[model samples]
Target chain A: MSPPESAPSIQDKLILLVEDNPDDETLTLRALSKNGIRHRIEVVRDGVEALDFLFARGAHATRVGWGMPTVTLLDLKLPRVNGLEVLRQIRADARTRNLPVVVLTSSREDEDLIQSYGLGANSYIRKPVDFVQFMDAVRQVGNYWLILNEEPPGHVP
Target chain B: MSASLIVPLALSASLVVAGLSWWNVVLHRRLRAGRDREEARCSAGPSPEEEQWRRAALEAAGQADQLRLQLRETQRELASLSYSISHDMRAPLRGIDGFSQALAEDYGDCLDATAHDYLRRVRAGATQLNLLIEDLLSLSRIVRAPYRPEEVDLSALVAAAAGELSAAEPMRQLHWDVQSGVAALGDRALLDVALRHLLVNAWKFTAGRIAARISFRVLETPGPEWPPGVPVYEVRDNGVGFDMQYAGKLFGAFQKMHVPEDFPGGRGIGLATVQRIVARHGGSVRADATPQEGAAFTFSLTSAPAGGEPPGAEVALPAGRMPVPGPGMTVPRHPTNAR
Candidate 1:
């Protein structure tokens, strides 16, 4: 099926997308383009890479003078470090503790929601099955977290 | 003449004693013969056929013992596996949910709404996985926890439960009628879980009603055959009740009277958990309801002694008195309202 229609006027914001699937990553990028949110997007395959990107550790260590992203969109399932552990780590560290974290997943379980909130997730939303609906959710999340909500200054690594 | 009579009496007595001794001897001989026969049969030693029978019996006993051990081991293994699966599966699901959330926050605007939605779906799916794990853990806990029975104030528990419910759904116009002074002997925790499930069910079912009326009270009936007084706790609610035909399966795991889509949420394990908790506490639960009118759940604690007289017949609450509230439905007086 053809992708949804594009939105006018792309917003300029830096975003780091942590996703394992290449197709999903591409779809996410395409959706963002359609929404006119043409911010610089950095993609990571898993939680470990996402952490490295956030902390400027491992391979990202060479990239000096990098600042924390405005928000962290976390997926619960990951290859190395799981989302909850990542959140715990983020919350534990004073530098990234106040960083806005949202949990996006397909799970409708109460425990997951409770845990997300318990671990200090800013918001939790379930992904829609339909492609168009999915796009709407993405747009709303982007509009709400990026343009609407005010976030703290970047954490220095 | 006297000496002759005495001599005859003594001879007769001797004769009688001799006869008795002779009979006793004969009886001893017969007993010895019977004992010999039994001993001979026992000591004859097993023939080939007898030996085979004896060996088969021993083997059957050994096999039975082995089977019993294997069954026990299997049960233990199953319990452990379920526990591990519930515990270990959460970490990965958390990772999926967390990272997707992170992705949305950081790059949501860069991506179109569709991509953001997909990520949200992934996160929701992970969250559902986590809930399934939790439900399994709850079921396991109900089975594994030790049960200790004690006197539980049903009135106080019911009042507290009602207060909590009111606090939760303050918007709803709820009428709670909980009797006072109801008490029973049961495991407090298990009973609490069961009662909570019932109250929660009541709350959910009555959601559509403009005015919800929930009652926690004890119904005293004559015990069958044994005693006059039997106390049964009843939790009644004016809500959307279920069909009578499906009532038998209401307590089965994952059994739902309504579709998941309609309910929007729930693992359908609440009633099953309640049933398990009740069974563990040696109690019985049954639901009675019509489609739209309401539902009443009644359960009895097995550990309670049968009342000697009809409830309220013997206790005689003072003039104009009434029975106490059921467990977990009490309403605490507001601090300012205290006398």
Candidate 2:
């Protein structure tokens, strides 16, 4: 666990990206930047880090300046923990249950897609192989979560 | 008077002998008639027990066919599962692609000639991965696409394919030989995809020729497994054909007989798609090609029975029932409670 005092600053309307791979994290950020999304973005490299950030524990214990992010772009496959397990925990907790979780994974499997929806995923998008298309999909997520969609009471500080 | 008495005794002896011979003939005839009646009763077709056995054997064969169909369904489900697994493989590939592109774009001048070459190789690998991912996705989609049977004018289908090809290269001169009113019973969209793949193959392989001819017509002969008069459509082209030895690999995904330089298009997914669509409609495909001469692709089609769900139809989840907190949330199955 990271030191509790050095909590990363939390801000409203932040997009929390839960991705284990650094390459995907960078690509996702690049895609968001290309789409003109400038809202504060947080990157957690694994499922455990994501849980720590959302629940305000471990290194993020003092992250009380802002509420939870407007949306979480989660990848299903992760190291330390799986994305599905993270989502299950999020839905189980009272504070982050209503948070919008957009599962942006590279999985095109019907089981994963349907099960994500069944488990209360706000939107499910399979990452496109083409960077240009991936950029467009990321743009839509930004638009929907940051601009169009209304914030849940828990997410708004 | 004594001589007359002797003549009368001789006549009486001759009449008794004749009567005995006639009775022997009548008894023999009655015995023969009774034997013929018994033989006819024994040889009157099969017995009732044998008839029952024959019926049971036929019923068993029918059940076996049904079981085969169920097996096919299970295979399709397995394919869906595998496709889901492949989805996870794309993540690292994208990371490799994305970071390499970023490195090239953001820090190009910092690297020398050797580094640039390495970066270029990395980009090339990423591009290849992208192409593979696209093919994989489309192939999965072809396996799962909806199918609805209707009368498809194959002439129109070929024409549409040719129209697109010609549209792509308007200046090129090509001749088309399409049979009129050639129709089949299948999903029209799927037939269109199959025809496009075949036609595109023809157009691609014939790129070296000055003037090439492509034909679309129905084969008079049926496939080996199909009954007589079952329609088999052929797409023949005068192109740089492949050897007969490699024909077996034609319908396999990612199977290539020619280099990208020689064929110049596609990643070997066209024929696989054609095969899948044709099979879903209860048909088969066969190819005959001669190296540096020509090739002919024949595909047959038969509509599926009514009320049969298409592949991947079972995977559709009811969207409305996923209960969120605000609205449209109905069924509340706790996903995490494994106990």
TM-score of each: 0.47, 0.67
Q: Which has the greatest TM-score? A: 2
Candidate 1 Cα outliers beyond 4 Å, as residue runs: A1-157, B1-75, B102-110, B222-230, B259-264, B303-339
lDDT of 2 by residue, A1-157 (tens): 4334444444336889998877788889899998899887889988999998998788777676556888899999888988888999999988889999999888767778888988889999988765667888998889988999998876522
DockQ of each: 0.03, 0.47
Q: List the residue pairs that clash in candidate 2.
A: B323-B329
lDDT of each: 0.63, 0.68
lDDT for each residue of candidate 1 in B1-339, tens digit (9 for 90 to 100)? 212332233223223322322333333333334334444554465457544544443443344344334434433544555434543454455456555766777788899988988997897787676666667656655654555667789888888988998898788888999989998866688788888888988888888787789999988662353223446789999898889999998876667887776566767778877776665443457788998999999876542245432111112322322212223322221111111
- Write down the DockQ of candidate 1: 0.03
Ten residues in sequence with the least summed lDDT for candidate 1 chain B: B330-339
Judged by whole-model lDDT over C-alpha atoms, candidate 1 comes out at 0.63
Q: How far off is residue B141 in model 2, in Å?
A: 4.5
Cα lDDT, model 1, residue A124: 87
